[model samples]
Target: MAETQKEILVRYLQSAREALLWKLDGLGEYDVRRPITPTGTNLLGLVKHVASVELGYFVSCFGRELPVPLPWLEDDAEINADMWATPDESREDIVGLYHLSWEASGRTFDELELESEGEVPWWRPGQRTVTLQQLLVHMIAETNRHAGHADIVRETIDGAAGLRAGVSNLPDEGFDWPSYVDRVESAARTFRASDG
Candidate 1:
């Protein structure tokens, strides 16, 4: 049977989620939690942030309370609290919350028609209203964007880059990446000024 629109949306959303999570696999705790970018992006933190936003969009925006407690999202929480896992927050804790968010989001998907309308509390007054379909697309984009970040962060950590396990989706396995980088850099250098 042909797949439904909802199924297609869910499939893409799940794919992005899996890709983001896979970036953390086989890494030690410090590696997963440590900020990779100067702006402080990390693997476990991305998972936590995604999970928090998922619950907000799928659950709370639809007139339902969050199924899990996210103290990081509370009014008094520190700025960017959702962007990094604290030392006390175990890898399992963040990943577990993300798993729970999948369940909560799944229920929302199962219970609501794509046209069902909801309000985003944090959005501007006139623009807070949205349909489930719009939110699905928005979330797919959101998750995939962060998944891309995870791809770079993971690569920086240990040179692992791919859509998922056993699927590099890159050039030939033995391709010379160093030579490729040199050629690209040399091309850019052709436009450089002669000044020291």
Candidate 2:
């Protein structure tokens, strides 16, 4: 059976969401909240940022009001709340809010046709209008890029490497773990010696 354009977009968006969520798997509050970079890229913060962006594009951009008022907004202030999570924000709360945002966004996406246009009031006048399809593509790409960062951050936290939960399905089951580490260390030393 041929899938509709909406189906494909939804699938991709869902995949990216799953990948992002997967990064939080088997991780504790300390790990999820720990800043991995100078910019404070934490798992919970990433989830919160995505939720804010998705709500803006899929809901607010389409003239659909958000259920809750955005906390970062202030009088005559252009605070970009989507950049990071606040200290008081708990891991569960952010993740739950993100899931809710996904549902709200998904509902909007499902109801709108690919050609249905909406004006982003925040954008330049002529460039404000966009189709649901465009937003879907943009969100998918944006989410995946963050997911890549999540993958690296998660791996660095605990040596857990893979696209999703569990060990990656590698065919090299016969390889010894200790020997693999030794070989990698040997290669590093050899490279350093060559440089010196």
Query: RMSD (Cα, Å) of candidate 2?
Result: 3.4
Q: Pick the candidate with the highest lDDT.
A: 1
Per-residue alpha-carbon lDDT of candidate 1 for residues 46-165, written as tens digits (9 for 90 to 100): 999999999999999999888878899999999899999998999999999999999999999999999999999899999899999999999999999999999999999999988899
* TM-score of each model, paired residue for residue: 0.96, 0.82
Candidate lDDT scores, in order, read 0.94, 0.82
Worst 10 residues of 1 by lDDT: 187-196
lDDT of 1: 0.94
Model 1 segments beyond 4 Å from truth? 194-196
Q: Could you tell me the lDDT of residue 31 within candidate 1? A: 97
Worst 10 residues of 2 by lDDT: 73-82
